[model samples]
Target chain A: MSSILKVQGINKHFGGLHALNNVNLDVEQGKVHAIIGPNGAGKSTLLNCFIGRLTPDTGTVDFDGTSLIGLKPHEINQTGVSRVFQTPEIFTELTLLENVMIPALAKRDGAFKPSLWSSMAGETEIRDQAMNALSEVNMGGKAGMTAASLSRGDKRRLELAMALVQNPKLLLLDEPTAGMARADTNATIDLLKTISGKGLTMVIIEHDMHVVFSLAEKISVLAQGTVIVEDLPEKIKGHPKVQEAYLGGAHL
Target chain B: MTVEQSKKDKIMVIGVVLAVLLGPIILNPFGAGYPDLLQKFVIYGIFAIGFNILFGLTGYLSFGHAAFLGVGSYSAVWMFKLLSMNIVPAIILAMVISGLFALLIGFIALRRSGIYFSILTLAFAQMSYNLAYSVLTPITNGETGLQILHGDPRVLDAAVEDGALPVTNLFGLNMNATADVSLLGMDIQFNAGYYICGLIMIVAFYIALRLFRSPFGMMLKAIKTNQNRLNFTGVNSRPYTLTAFVISGIYAGLAGGLLACTDPLAGAERMQWTASGEVVLMTILGGAGTMLGPILGAGVIKYFENIFSAYNESELMDVFSFLPHWLQELVVSVSSLFVGEGWHLTLGVLFMLIVIFLPGGLMEGFNRLVKLARGGYRKDGASASAAGKVTAE
Candidate 1:
């Protein structure tokens, strides 16, 4: 499979401290690529760069051969890259259905079309897509409920629904299963597995070993701001470089 | 939308149109039956509604909207002075100019949100006020205000019949003309100017309703709720917010133009920062995010400004006539502080009470009442909606 998102020689700094050090990644199409690391390994910082939340000090991030550097977050998002924030950045005051509809509208309408006169409820196609995305995560029944009333797991699901409804070419998830209960985490993994079967590319930053091992087709272990190893999930388990650089701790 | 939701929307539009058409009759019981007072209510209602479109949806609090209103009034009045006495041209020019003005100010002021945005708007409005008061005297006429004079160019007007001040009109329909009808022993005066302003306000309210139900509005609310998420959602909030700001600015302009049509004068005081703050109070006092809240807030505040200020010591004596002489004297002395010249104190107290008891504004108060009437079902949603409004900052 061709690489859909290619990163090379990405470096970032905070004063004297190096946050991301000459990192490189090649995410393939139609696969779940997991980035695993200990805390402060620059996994989130790297994800932020992908979504244009932070600019790398120096390097290139090419999505489908288009450079993503210096683009505003929304501009980057408009280029078919959608992100699920670690903390589930859902619209707290809006309904779940409405929450999902926004990104769908954004995806179809581009950055700004000024769809001022069109009634949002009248966007039947987008609405149906949003509903389908919601029920995909088992949230179709509570579409009318305000998002603020959602539990953390449900908020994460709604956020996932929001990202999915966009039909993005590349999905970046920052800790998709972080803070989820065991049952919720397992359900999310199953949901993600089904999504990956549809031939969508996703890059996930995760701490949960179960989620990582279950869903990731290829694993890239990040340690000390650089990729220590990149290989199939089966090979990644006992790779001595990954074991020494990251997995050397009690985690299997 | 569901059948019930659209049905409610239809009813709401019908209700607003009917209320505006029958404003004089409806306001008669409240002692605001006169055409002039009713004009203020409708005009300011338009102002507040437009203000709410900005402050309500996207959570951008602008303290410089009065500048747009002032610009609209000046544009309309200029149209009258240079072109015609017809309000159609005046109103159109007013909206267009104010929309441009909003685009300029909104472009600059919308750069930083929250308190910084508000302060930037406040500064812009204050600067405009100072300019209109002094530097722009050639156009604005300074403290005396711009007025059409005898022999002044009114190219579209038919040669100023015997130097009588030209009355504002819509295609020769007299704006200042009024007719009185007695209903149930209460006299209600319906002025042509009031009806024109009333019709325009109804249209404005309808547009606001459509905007509220639009996808653009949802995007705006999303920005208000979580802009960070919206950015990642692939929507650029700047243009959306700028559009809302311009639209509301145009609303303020429409209100300003109507104010000019009502009296045929545009003054610098109309652009004062305090005047801008008044729209903020009107929106918050009504319920910033709700459809009908700002109009209701404007109506209540204007009513207090006109009626409460009309009260005097004699009115107090008549109201307290039933009490004993000593008690009446004591009551009048105490009550007098809250009326007449001190009516602002009464308004302030009332405003404080509403904000404290109903942080969601009068809409929340009505929601509570409606919930109470329905045995308090869906109890969580009332507080949920209220919580939505309180997070506007």
Candidate 2:
């Protein structure tokens, strides 16, 4: 499979500490790739670099043949790279439908549309697409509910719907199951599986082994700001390097 | 955009029009039906409404909006001095000039948000006020203010008949012209200028209502909620906020122009920080995010400043005539601090009470009254639903 996202020789430093050291990763098209690591493993930092939230010390992040090094977050999103934040970053003051519709409207009209005089009522196409995305996440019934009033799980689902409405090619999920209950995590894994069935590539940074093993076709073990093992999920289970990195080489 | 919303907008427009048209009759009962006070009501109503679009919807409290109002007044006065006595060109020039000023201020102020943004705008306004009072004296006419002069060139106006001072007019309809009608032992005066300002205020209100319902308005509220989410959603919110700032500035300018149209003088004191605070007070007191809130707040504040302040010790004694002598003496001594020249003391206390009790302003008070009138309050469901509606803004 062709690589949809290619990160080569990526390095980032915060003050005197090395955050990401010569990191190299490739996410294949239409595949679920999990980046599993311990705390302070630079997983979120790497994700931030990919989404233009941070500028790396030295690196090349290639998404669909375009360099995402200096682009704004909104510009990077426009290139069909959507991110579901670790903490559900939905518009809390807006309705669930409006929360989903904002990204959809941005996609339809662009980063800036002078829609001052134009009414939003005529945008039936965008509304329908947003509604469909909400239904895909099983949140279609509470479309009119205020986002702030939603439960944590429902807010996560609404945020997922918002990302989905953009119809992005590469979805970056940062700990999609972070703080979720077992049943909710399982439901999320099922939702990810259904999304994967539609042939969308995803890069997930997760701490939960069950979620990582269940959803990821390929797994990469990261520790001390570098990848220690890259292999299939089955092979990663028995990897010596991954165990050493996680257990501090004590039980060799 | 929905049928219900459209109907609501229609009703709001009709209601505002009716109110403005009959202000003379409606306000007569409160002894504030005269042209001068009524004109102040509508002018400041426009000012507060414009201020609300930025502060209410976007949650950006600019403490420098009065600078734009002062700019509009100066521009209108200049137009009157150079062009003609007609108010059309003057008002139009005021809006254009203030819009440009807003563009510059907004471009810089929007770079920093929250308290920083407020500080930047306040600084700009203070600078403008000082310049207008001193350095820009040639344009602003300094501390004495810019007023119509006899030796000036009113290019479009005809020669003054019988050497009388030139008066402002709308295509020969004198703005100062008034019709008095005696009704129920009270005299009602309706001036042409008040009606002109009143009409413009209605138009401004309608535009504000449309803006509140528009998608652009939704985007603004989203910015207020979570600007980071909007940026990540692939939408740039700066231009939207700048547009709101300019639109509001234009509204302030229009109000300023209307002030000039009525009085024919532009003062540097209009740009003072206290003037900006008054508009902020009006918006918050009425209801920042509601359509009717700013206008209601403006009316209340203006009525107290004009009508309530006019009451003397004799009037107070007349009001307290029913009470016993000791009670009257005790009440007058305490209440004296809140009326006459100390009316601001009453306003300050009222403002404090409203902020402490009803943070949502008079609109929230009205909503609670309605809820109480309906069937008394339920425990959780009512407030929860109300909170849901608030967040939906």
Which model scores highest in lDDT? 1
Assess each prediction's global lDDT (C-alpha) against the native. 0.90, 0.89
Candidate 2's displacement at residue A175, Å, is 1.3
True contacts kept of each: 0.68, 0.50
Provide DockQ values for all models, in the order shown.
0.52, 0.52
Q: How close is candidate 1 to the true structure, as a TM-score?
A: 0.96
lDDT of 1 by residue, B1-393 (tens): 555567889998999999999889888998998988999999999999999889999998999999999999999999988999999999999999999999999999888999999999999999999999899999999999987776668887756546578889988889989988777898879799999999999999999998999988898999899988898888899999999999999999999999999888999999998899889888899999999999999999899989999999989999999999999999999999999999999989989999999999998999888878988567686655553333211
Residue range B1-393, candidate 2, lDDT tens digits: 445567777887888899999899999998889999999999999999999999899999999999999999999999989999999999999999999999999999999999999999999999999999999999999989999888778887746533776888898888999999897787889889999889889889878877877678878888899988888888888998999999999999998998999999999999999999899999999999888899999999999999779977878888998999999988888788789999999899999999999999998999889788999686544554554344233
Quote model 2's TM-score: 0.96
Q: Model 1, clash count?
A: 0
- What TM-score would each prediction reach against the true structure? 0.96, 0.96
Scored against the native two-chain complex, candidate 1 gets a DockQ of 0.52
What tens digits encode model 2's per-residue C-alpha lDDT throughout A1-252? 899999999999999999899999999999999999889999999999999999999989999999999998889999999999999998887778788888998888788875766666666677788889988888776776778888887888888899999989999999888777788789889999999999999999999899999999999888989998899999999788888888888776
Residue ranges of candidate 2 with Cα displaced over 4 Å? B1-3, B160-162, B183-186, B376-393
Give lDDT: candidate 1, residue B91: 96
